[model samples]
Target: MHVNARFWDRLAPRYARMQVRDPDAYERKLAMTRAFLGPEAQVFEFGCGTGTTALKHAPHAGHVTAIDCAPAMIGIARQKAAEAGIGNVEFRVGDLADMPDSPGAYDMVMAHNVLHLLPDRSGALARVRRMLKPGGVFVSSTACAAGAPRLFRWVAKAGHALGLLPLFNLLTADGLRAEIAAAGFEIVEDWRPEGGRAPVLFLIARKPA
Candidate 1:
């Protein structure tokens, strides 16, 4: 998938409800994140689509600067934050290539599932690296085919062929670790989902102090 504005606009409804269907999964990730973040720290969530994760994690952090490339996504996110009455978050529409951000402005930066969309994830990681406070964490997750069913694997490749799965970098654990290391981040935590059924690799890495 191209992952442009249209792709997200089409995915908005389903994306908004993903948390409800898998709250446990999301909650687990949040718990992992809280392990690294200070109680009053600032969080910068790049590609914070629909604000679901932002709303869930905002109360824990002192503040959240949520951003997404799609204006439509940010529009809905702002509304969600407002309806939740969360006053600590600020939403912006911008791409990872050029963030409307000052360098080293956040204690932590989150990329979520955005890495797979990047054609050059290491370069993107470098961009994010320069934007964090020294020793800040870069928490992210990406799709992987390491545990996919053979049929699903075939389907994913087919989806790519059909352009429904444009450019996803299915980074296995070691692959991702190397990518982060190459970008000058140390692996703080890393895990592959159990059972080899879910094709996702979740991780946390940080710039050296």
Candidate 2:
């Protein structure tokens, strides 16, 4: 985890720039996520790189606590939030498991594009489940690397071996949904936006009320 944090800290600037690569697709994600949000919602987003998505979510949510393990990423997120005059978001450098707050504190928990990279996907999902209010949503977008072409999977493996990529769990879309369900969420939206070479699963799952 420390190594992954350092890697992300180093990549913060470039990653922030890369956030704009697909404006339409990014907006679509925001739209889909927003659909589950309410004006009084309290949101927590893990692996919130550079805070772009958090800032985007702030208008619809009452408060947002966005966290990243990388200090550099949090620093950038704070700077961006300041520049945007966004007051609803509190950017912090920490992981979900280490957050000092109590469980069932948030109306929504988001883990976009970060689930597949975690070493313990089911454990993380379970933690997120415990963090939400009953009926609250877990909104996530994950790259289904298990559905990727063999060549792409091989390249990802090579990158991991070289320590250039974080751990990949290679979960398929169905597998991811099953994991979420097993974690006690009721799957709501399971979608894949068009265009990416690899399948990218966008899901909205709710903790039973």
Candidate 3:
């Protein structure tokens, strides 16, 4: 995901205007995530595009710190937060690597639809692990490019090659689980919702107590 910010900056406006393709599936993910949150929770989210999920989760947590690499994305996110009068979530223009090296800082860390897009997936997961308090949870929903149809995979790669898409890793759901485990997080919930155009791997993992 570390590339020129212009790519995402160009997409920010249209991304904000787009509607959720599956409201039911989206609500299910939201509910599942909310179950892990509490009023005393301190939450951190990386690769937060437009701050939608962060804003939604704010009511359940004490504070939400969300970051994205693209300035345009953060700009739009800040606007959304102000318009919605949501004051608990702080949206910033930064990458995961820019996050402070503060171990055990957050009660929960989330990365939704972001893992497969990272060029350094293992490094990012390790960072997430370090940022969470012991026994705290990491929740993620990743697009499993390895599980996509052959034609889609080919097209995605071609698009990346032509600079039409961002960096993407063809990581399988099993491989993602293995990586999270290797990062010293215990997988507690592994789920895949049905009837999606592509496979999404939803997981809740906890740092060792």
Question: lDDT values of the candidates?
Answer: 0.79, 0.88, 0.90
Give the best candidate by lDDT: 3
Best by TM-score: 3
lDDT of 2: 0.88
Where is model 3 poorest over a 10-residue stretch in terms of lDDT? 1-10
What is the TM-score (0 to 1) of candidate 1? 0.87
Candidate 3 residue runs with Cα over 4 Å from true position:
1-4
Model 1, span 1-209: residue lDDT tens:
23466678787777876645345666788899888776678888878889888887888889999888777789889999899999999999877777655788878889887887677887788888888889999999777655556787687667767766545555576777788898999888887566433566788988888
Q: Between 1 and 2, whose TM-score is larger?
A: 2
- For candidate 3, give the lDDT of residue 93: 89
- Compute each candidate's TM-score over C-alphas: 0.87, 0.94, 0.95
Off by over 4 Å in 2: none
Residues 1-209, candidate 2: write the lDDT tens digits.
57789799889889888846567877988888898889999999999999989999999999999999999999999999999999999999998778875688989999988998898777788888888999899999898878678888898888888988777778888888888888999988877878765678889999999
What would the per-residue lDDT of candidate 3 be over residues 1-209, giving only the tens digit for each residue? 54447788999999999998778888988998888899999999988999999999999999999999999999999999999999999999899987679899999999998898888888998898989999899999999878677898898788888888887789898899999999999999888989888789999999998
Tally clashes: model 1: 2
